[model samples]
Target: MSKPVIIIGAGGHAKVLAESLLRGDQTILGFTDPDASATLFEGIPYLGTDAIIFEHRPEEILLVNGLGSVGDNRTRQAMFSSFTAKAYRFTRVIHPSAIISHIEVEMGSGCQILAGALINPGARLGNNIIINSHAVVEHDCRIGDHVHISPGAIICGNCTIDDMAYIGASSTLKQGVNIGKGAIIAAGAVVINDVPSYTLMAGVPAQQKHQLQGGVK
Candidate 1:
């Protein structure tokens, strides 16, 4: 039997997630969002608020966290933790168009690897991560939980990105660079150094713009 999936957000990212799931031939039960205006998501029904998950048995349907993190990933992480506490299991959504090389790749639950993304061999991705469209993860990279490697971002070989880090669109991280937890790498920035925790790095060579005290809000 095909496992039914309930998507947790009804936004643009949810549309992408829906398309990925559909391409994988997975059955989608519907979406859950607080926005009553969202009656339909990419032609999929909106199954009311997120509280609706309590109505279904967790074991019977898997969850897909459609909430995307532009900077702060706490919302996505919170949703995953909440659902997990309720004994709900999450599904990893990988687009058919994505290229996965013959490498030892380990992915945690609730990850979304989008179309045109390339995950090289010997890479490890943590829970609730977003490898957005056309993003490239080179060999031996480690990406942490709730990290959003935005569209077209290139993570070079042997890089380490810690939890809740957001690498903006088209940004490139040099090989062997370490990005600390909760750091934000700006769009188009080229990172060549280790970023400190909760730091905002921008510009070419990626200087620290500011420290995100207490992390992203």
Candidate 2:
């Protein structure tokens, strides 16, 4: 029997994850958030703050990282890491509408493949990654840890996205392009070349706009 899951957050993304779980018929226990009065889908119980999770015990309930992403993923990554350090296991949530390859695609823990996403064959994805609604990861793409492919983003064939990178909504990457760690591709940008680490890129042809800091190695 699969373990019952407790979603960890009460934000918009958390609600979406709940819907996915419900659609898939997974066992859902409840949810947790900082706000004691937080409400969830179908009136799922508010199980108090994150501190209340200690009562459940790691071996008993699986965890789902329900935090959403606007760009940076450090907080989400940190949440997964902290829970796993205490021997907690994270459950991967895949929406029924998302399409994924049946072969040559390896996805790591805490991955959320949301509604309307299409992941082509031979793509390898890492931990705590989110392939948001309507995003397309084309053939043989390699995505590193904590990467978020925002809604409507298109990653072309054989692209490499390094750790903690964020592909903004509606952005398009050309074939074989490489995105470096901590890089942020601004919304609607079109990328044709390799982007450097810790940089922010924006525009029709995507140019480096600013330098950022602190990404996973």
Candidate 3:
């Protein structure tokens, strides 16, 4: 929460956050990406590899987790944990257009509540979370660390989404459902029952299609 911030990745998600930040007084120092040519914006300078972040002291600047997570969040989670271990705190990116019904909710660090997203009362969100554009988190939902609630995803009331679970775009979770750690819900899936850890849930009324691997459980 400072004057200037450095985005950790250069991608579509990074650009979206950049536009929102630019609307306010938030100054983007630069972005770190391995491939500089991939940077789309003209103004934001391209900082070299992610290692370049160490050039600045942790207290002087705030960092943003610009890495977008689809179904897997291990890479994003790792990046955040590495910096947090060194006492580098990531800034919260709450888009101006988002609607939050509760002010007393427990929201952890490095979370992005994006444009048009709606969070109802009693939602406790954990670190490195992305409540993507137009997504809905209903009352009393418990969302854990590094979770990616994709664009247009609807998480119903009293749902408990454990750490690193990926709720895909346009997916709907039934009330009181529990999505275990590292569970991957495919796009448009309707999750009615509880999904276990490292499981791949897909289709309407989501079925456990396979046991997922390479996920951070």
Candidate 4:
């Protein structure tokens, strides 16, 4: 049998990724976290920080941020860049329970597809993207790199979700809507139009509350 792959991050998100990777026929060597007081999680050892990546020399590693909120998305992007600069390869993980159409779907490394997530045919998922449990990506949706589709969010057909975008829990995107990069759609928002980048949108019809760079509304 091949050696298990390494996983970065040891928090709640990492836990889910670990299980998903295992279910996808990938071995988890261990986890790397800044705080490693705990010995094991889900029966896997919590190794020290990224230093172990160089020592163990696993074939590939998965980058898992698992941090909630859009603010964490920037942090995860930086972390992934740093890891790649150090010449470490990353892997994409998808749970076996998820339903994906046979159409061509492009996914970046370290992506997590949780149980009950349905990705329809012709969908493109970027690197390090997170399709949380039960999220539905309808046909021809394009999800950019590092975006997080919160649990139970529904992305209708032909939607374009830009990089680092966060679709809050249970939010629904109408078909063909374009969500700009780094935009945050609040929980239960029903998006009927395009969302500008770096803005926070909320409410039933999903209107922009404030510009992220300027101030909160």
User: Candidate 4: which stretches are off by over 4 Å?
Assistant: 1-3, 39-42, 58-71, 214-217
TM-score of each: 0.97, 0.97, 0.96, 0.90
Where is model 3 more than 4 Å wrong at Cα? none
Per-residue CA lDDT of candidate 2, range 5-64, in tens?
999999999999999999999988999999887888875888888888899889999999
Candidate 4, residues 21-52, lDDT tens digits: the string is 76767767677778868443556777788777
Candidate 1 lDDT (Cα, 0 to 1)? 0.91
Clashes of each: 0, 0, 0, 2
What is the C-alpha lDDT profile of model 3 across 35-66, one tens digit per residue? 96768478889988889999999888899999
Ranking by lDDT: 2, 1, 3, 4
- What digit string (tens of lDDT, one per residue) describes model 1 on residues 1-217? 8689999888789889898888888899999998878854456788889999899998789999999878888898899999999899999999999998876999999889999999999999999999999999999999999899999999999999999899999999999999999999999999998999999999998898898964563
Which parts of model 2 are misplaced by more than 4 Å?
215-217
TM-score of 4: 0.90
Cα deviation of 124 in candidate 3 (Å)? 0.3
Q: Residue 58 CA error for candidate 1 (Å)?
A: 1.4
Q: Over the full model, what C-alpha lDDT does candidate 2 score relative to the true structure?
A: 0.92
- Please say which candidate is ahead in lDDT: 2 or 4: 2
